[model samples]
Target chain A: MMVVISYDVSTETADGKKRLRKVAKACESHAQRVQNSVFEADLDYSSFMKLKGELLKIMNKDTDSMRFYYLGNHWQRKVEHFGIKKGYNPEGTIIV
Target chain B: MMVVISYDVSTETADGKKRLRKVAKACESHAQRVQNSVFEADLDYSSFMKLKGELLKIMNKDTDSMRFYYLGNHWQRKVEHFGIKKGYNPEGTIIV
Candidate 1:
């Protein structure tokens, strides 16, 4: 399955900034950054559950929010992007 | 059609901040703000095109990027949200 994870962590305090970095790092480990706070990844059922659990622990309920869009396995057809930066396929190979 | 619009505006400079506000305003006019930088809306083809064009004009190509996720009309099942804040249906009626 392919999931699109987008989050907003309140950065009003030092703790909030730390949480934001942790959350971003967690997402980056499992997916590719699609935007500043949005990521795209293709994972199995177990990996997806683990990723979700990790993120849930990092974000504050009172000041932070996250959304997961289940793009399924055919997300390429569902997304339309506009800008100079183009998105990379979640299933594609990268040399880097 | 249902569209999910998300953006990342570079806010390093005064001009970038201004552009960010403008881009956000453009999105809010047509959609419900789902997160800090994400929005969801149900719009017709012409309306979607107009909104996209307006946003494109406001965002800088070199410093900003935007994405539109076409969830068709059955977006209710495609989205999975997490956190304290709950999501409202784009098709639902709002008294305010």
Candidate 2:
């Protein structure tokens, strides 16, 4: 199970650039630098937890000016590849 | 079905900024700008084709420094929502 994190940040921090680089460094090889404030990474459960720990340490928690998203697991690609099969009540909740 | 395009550019062009702007304009509302050279868009099949057409017109076919990617459909959210169920031989091709 891998996780992808997307953070929407309002570029208002005095050290936002430094913080962003720190986050990128944590990504190592499981990441693809997508946009300025977005990064795509393939991380397992443990890695996801590790990333969360790292992110929270540098996040600006005093305001809602920043948001974080967690896209969990590689299985998402499968779901994208094949949605719920017909006659399966595709709208029902599914396991990751 | 919407598609997401990721293009990597070498940043060496007389009018790279112009071309990039044109591409961003084509995105309209379904796109999110990420970095200097990356963008993410939720696009349908037809829209993908339209984007392909637009991109090709500005592409420098002579260079190998650029690349494009396509992530298709809104069902992606489902895939991202839930991966293949267990015991389903999840590796087989999916219906998208």
Candidate 3:
């Protein structure tokens, strides 16, 4: 499954900024950062759940918001790119 | 077709900030703001092209970037909400 994760974390204070970094780091562990606050990853059901849990723990629910778009397995046909391309491939070999 | 438009406009300069607002305004005309820099719209091919052209004119290609995700007609099944739902429905009726 391909999951697209997008988040908005309030950065008004020092703690907020720290939370933002933590949330981004959690997402970066499993996904490719396609935009400033958006990521795309190809993951199994269990891995998706793990990532979701990790992000939930990092983000402040009171001020931060997140959305997950499940592109399923046919994401290649579903995505279109424009402007500066980063050559992001969710299915490509990840050198982790 | 449901198009998810996400953009990253350089906001360091005054002109860049203006361009960011312009780009966002163009997207708001035809879509729902699902996130700070992301929008989702259910538009026909012609309308999508018009919106794309309008955004291209507003954003600077040299420093700004954008991505469009085509979710096809069955977008409802493709999108999932987590943390702070904004009640966005690309298929819902628009007053305008």
Clashing pairs in 1: none
> Candidate 1 residues B2-92, lDDT tens each?
8888887656588876876676677666877777668887899999899889988988877677888887877789887776564433332
Model 1: residues >4 Å from true position, as ranges?
A: A84-96, B86-96
Query: Relative to the unseen true structure, what is the C-alpha lDDT of residue A92 in candidate 2, on a scale of 0 to 100?
Result: 17
TM-score, per-candidate, Cα-based: 0.82, 0.49, 0.82
Q: Evaluate all candidate structures by whole-model CA lDDT and list the values in order.
A: 0.75, 0.44, 0.73
**CAPRI tier of model 2:** incorrect
DockQ of each: 0.64, 0.03, 0.56
Docking class of 1: medium
lDDT (Cα, tens digit) per residue for candidate 3, span B16-60: 768766766787668877766778889999999999889888877
As a TM-score, model 1 comes out at 0.82
Which regions of candidate 2 fall more than 4 Å away from where they truly are?
A2-14, A29-38, A59-96, B7-14, B29-40, B59-96
Give the alpha carbon lDDT tens digit for every residue of A1-96 in model 2: 434344433345746545666656665455655434445556666766676677677655542122233444433552221111211111211122
Looking at model 1, what is the TM-score of chain A? 0.80
TM-score of chain A of each: 0.80, 0.57, 0.80
